[model samples]
Target chain A: AQTVTQSQPEMSVQEAETVTLSCTYDTSESDYYLFWYKQPPSRQMILVIRQEAYKQQNATENRFSVNFQKAAKSFSLKISDSQLGDAAMYFCAYKIPGNQFYFGTGTSLTVIP
Target chain B: DAGVTQSPTHLIKTRGQQVTLRCSPKSGHDTVSWYQQALGQGPQFIFQYYEEEERQRGNFPDRFSGHQFPNYSSELNVNALLLGDSALYLCASSLLEGRNSPLHFGNGTRLTVT
Candidate 1:
């Protein structure tokens, strides 16, 4: 079984500032996928970004990016120019082949004005 | 394009009662997945269905079952509900085996098992 861990339970960042959420995972599979999802107060889950294990280059999407260190089994999300809308619960997920998903406990992010 | 959708935005059930939740996949998506999100927790994968068959399932018990229709819409059935079964159930859709095909999610069905 694969398990994802988010050591930080909560985080805060001033608006327009930057923040990073840490994530670690345990897996024996050689190929897999990692993702970061955000759930706002409305309770809707939204995909923030994703990374493929086979790729060496980290994935970046505008204000969001990931530092994926496969050998260390770490995948962390970085949010730049954080906005109030970025305040939410952030999740780190693991997906091995066969399409099964494992999620971390999550980190609650708060963007302060 | 319309995104994934789930019905019964909210539901209330008692112990031993049965409940059915529905989902419609995003247009052009053939695979649908279900997840259970307990309050203050991340979503846990419940199962995945494709082409009217269950392709994979998570650690959930047999009481949690699902079915996929030809149109790629899906249903999640839970029997003998327990307090532990209370959650916000989410439905996600993706293209089968497409590299980097991320799953888009619905708002979710909030089930409160009393």
Candidate 2:
């Protein structure tokens, strides 16, 4: 079974600052995908970024990027120039090609203004 | 395009009662998956349906069952519900083709079993 672990329960970042949320997973499969999802108070889970395990290069989407270290089984999300709107619960997820997704406990982010 | 949508945004049920949650897949999507997210916890996969059949399921017991309609809409049925069954139920839709196809999620239905 694959399991994702998010060590941080809560995180805070000042406006215009940057913050990195850490995540690690245990999986023996060589082919997989990693993702970061954001859920605001509205309760909608939005995709932030995703990384393919086979790709050595990291994935970035606007201010959101992922530092994916396949060898270490570590996938972290970095939010650059954070804004108040970034305040939400972030979850790290892992998925195999055709299997169910495994998600971390999540980290509540507070964007300090 | 209309994303995945779930009905009864909020539902309250008592112990031993049965409840049903519905989900409509996103436009052009043929696969639907259901998840349960407890308070302060991550979402746990309940099951996935494709071609109107269950393709994968999590560790949930037989008390949790589901069905997928011809239109790719799905329904999750929980019987003999317990207080621990109270959680936010999310419905996600995605293409069943490739590995990296991302899942489109609905706002989720909050289920409260008292």
Candidate 3:
């Protein structure tokens, strides 16, 4: 079985500043995928960024990027130039070759003005 | 595109009662998966439907079942609902290709079992 862990329950960042959310996972599969998802007040879960375990280079999407350390089993999300709209609950997920998707407890992000 | 859409954004049921939640997949999507998100917890996979058959499931019991239509729409059915079953039910759509495909989610239906 695979599991994802988000140590931080809540985080806050000043507008225009940068913030990093930490996540870790345990999996036996050598080939897998990692993902970061955001859920706003509207309740829609949106994909933020994704990383392939085989890729040594981390994944970046506009302001959102990840620091993936495969050996350490760590995948963190960094939000640069944070805005008020970035305030939401962020979830870290893991998926293997199978369709089962495992998710962390989630971290609530607050962007302060 | 209209992403994924779920019907009855909110629902209330009692113990021993049954509930059915509907989900319409995003345009061009052929696979649908269902998840249960309890308050303050991440969503947990319930099952995945492809080609109108249950291709995968999680640790949930037989009480939880699902059906996928030819149009790629899906329904999650829970029987003998318990108070513990109260949570937000999410429907996600994606291509059946492989893990490379990301899931597009719908604003979940908040289920309350009283």
Candidate 4:
């Protein structure tokens, strides 16, 4: 079974600064997908960004990017120019060819103004 | 376009009871997946429904069941609920054809068991 781990339970970043949330997973599948999801206090889960294991180049979307190290089974999310809106529970997820999705314990991100 | 939508934003049930939560998939989506997010933990996959059939399931027990309609809407049913079942239930929809289809999630139903 695949499992995702987010070591940091809580993180804080000053406004306009950058922050990185660490994530690691255990999976034997050669090809898979990694994703970072943000769940605000309202309880709505929103997709931040995603990375494909086969892609060597890290995926970036605006201020959100991922540092994906397939060999180390590490996929970290980086948020630049952090804003107050970034405060939420961030989760790292893993999925393979199958349909099931495995998620990490989550990291609560607090944007300090 | 409308994203995934779930019904009964909140619910309360007692032990030995049954609860049913509904979900409407996003436009043009044909697959619906259900997840249970316990407090302080991540969302755990319950099952995935495609073509009105259960295409895949996780390690959840048989007490957890679901149904998918022809319109791609889905429902998650839990029987003999326990206090452990108190959590947020999320519904996600995605395209089945894409190798890496991103799941659009709903606001989720907060279930409270007593």
Cα lDDT tens digits, model 3, A1-113, are 79999999999999999999999999888999999999999999999999999999999999999999999999999999999999999999999865678999999999999
What value does DockQ give for candidate 2? 0.91
Better model by DockQ: candidate 2 vs candidate 4 = 2
Question: What TM value does model 2 have?
Answer: 0.99
Docking class of 2: high
Clashing pairs in 1: none
Report the C-alpha lDDT of model 1 over B67-98, residue by residue, as the tens digit: 99999999999999999999999999988878
Docking band of candidate 3: high
Best by DockQ: 2
DockQ values per model: 0.71, 0.91, 0.84, 0.83
Model 3: fnat (fraction of native contacts) = 0.84
Candidate with top lDDT is 2
Give candidate 4 misplaced runs (Cα > 4 Å).
Answer: none
**Per-residue alpha-carbon lDDT of candidate 2 for residues B1-114, written as tens digits (9 for 90 to 100):** 888999999999999999999999999998999999999999999999999999999999999999999999999999999999999999999999967988899999999999
Candidate with top TM-score is: 2
For model 4, the local distance difference test gives: 0.95
In every candidate, what fraction of the native interface contacts is reproduced? 0.68, 0.82, 0.84, 0.82
Q: lDDT by residue for model 4 over B5-33, one digit each (tens)?
A: 99999999999899999999999999999
Of 1 and 3, the candidate ahead on DockQ is 3
List candidate 1 stretches off by more than 4 Å.
none
TM-score of each: 0.96, 0.99, 0.98, 0.98
Cα lDDT tens digits, model 2, A1-113, are: 79999999999999999999999999999999999999999999999999999899999999999999888999999999999999999999999998899999999999999
